[model samples]
Target: MILLDAGTTYAKILNTETNEKTVKKVAELEKTFKADIGTGHNINRFAKQSVNEIIALSYAGKRLIKEKSFTLLDVGSRDAKYVIFENGNFIHSDWNTECGAFTGQAIEILGSYLNLNYNAIEPQKEFITATCGLLGMGHVFDMVASSVEPGIAAARLIKGVCMSMYRFARKPHKIYLTGGLVNNALFVKSMPVETICLDRFTLLEGVLEYAASKKDDINL
Candidate 1:
């Protein structure tokens, strides 16, 4: 079986039989290459079976996280979402599309434009009032124009972005974090709350898990 978590910019693919995983640009995936089970924005276009990203995350959270009560947040290319669980049971979930506009994309483009290495940027105390990625990026540009070092400006933007995500997740004491940002050290460090970064493949794992469970009832 194959599973895919295809986001706006990239696709995380998993071969269940081999337990091998690969990340590829969404544009590079052939139209004919479909997954047995899949989730994410672009998955519907190529997946034989589709699952809601949030539902996939819930399955992953229950399988991966050991905490009885916790918050799991998946900040993807286009948006941010979080699920709250109490005593191992999901209680609430929220997906922030409006204010989270182009968050991951913003970071990627800004880093490329600035030639900034997120792993090297230290989390800073001073951050712009991002409110959202677009507004935050505006602040970054203004700051850079004012002679703020490009790296510093970028760091501030990342911190602001992290803060926005934190606030949206209701500022949990500790977050179970996943998605593209998990690999960005600065983004992880900038998170105002304690954060546990999960593998970027977390969502793919969820898709695989769901496919396994439904194999007996559904043809795949």
Candidate 2:
């Protein structure tokens, strides 16, 4: 079986037969390999079967984690999404970029500006108010210009983003963090509840399942 995650920035192809995975530009659709299932935004462009991102995420989460109920947080490059799963079924799913908060892109840009290195910063009292990435970026510059330490500014900004996510998600008790920020220490610190970080292949796992379902339907 083969699975393809054709995303906007890059496409990830996995050959389940050989356990081989490769990442390439979205435009590199040169029939490199045949896929049994396809997912992500660009899946319809080339994939034989298309799966929604949220559906794939939910399915993958249920299979990998033992928890029957929890909030799945996906902090992506441009936006953040969360899905509530109960009894291995998706209950609620939502995506947001309100005030430019809960986005990995903003955090990355902010970190670069502040010159942050760690996954999470040490405990600090400072907290940024601006949730919008662009606005928060301006706030960082102003804070640094006013003599606030770079690291402190970074921590404050990161914490602010986390707060936005928590509040918007309705302060869930359990959370499973995924997406690119899953490995970031700063992101882990900002969460109020403990989170289990899953591998990046979580969504692909769901795609594989979806492909199997299609095959079963057609008796292939």
Best-matching candidate per lDDT: 1
In terms of TM-score, the best-performing candidate is: 1
Return the TM-score for each candidate structure. 0.95, 0.81
Candidate 2 lDDT tens digits, 104-142: 667777777567884646734556767577787788788
lDDT of 1 by residue, 1-220 (tens): 8888999889999887899989999999998998887899998898888988898898888888888898999998788888989998889899987654788888988898888888988889887766667777888999999999988998988888888888888878999999999999999999998899999899987776776777786578
Off by over 4 Å in 2: 8-11, 22-36, 42-48, 97-102, 123-125, 216-220
**lDDT, each prediction:** 0.87, 0.72
Clashes of 2: 4
Worst 10 residues of 1 by lDDT: 209-218
Per-candidate clashes come to 0, 4
TM-score of 1: 0.95
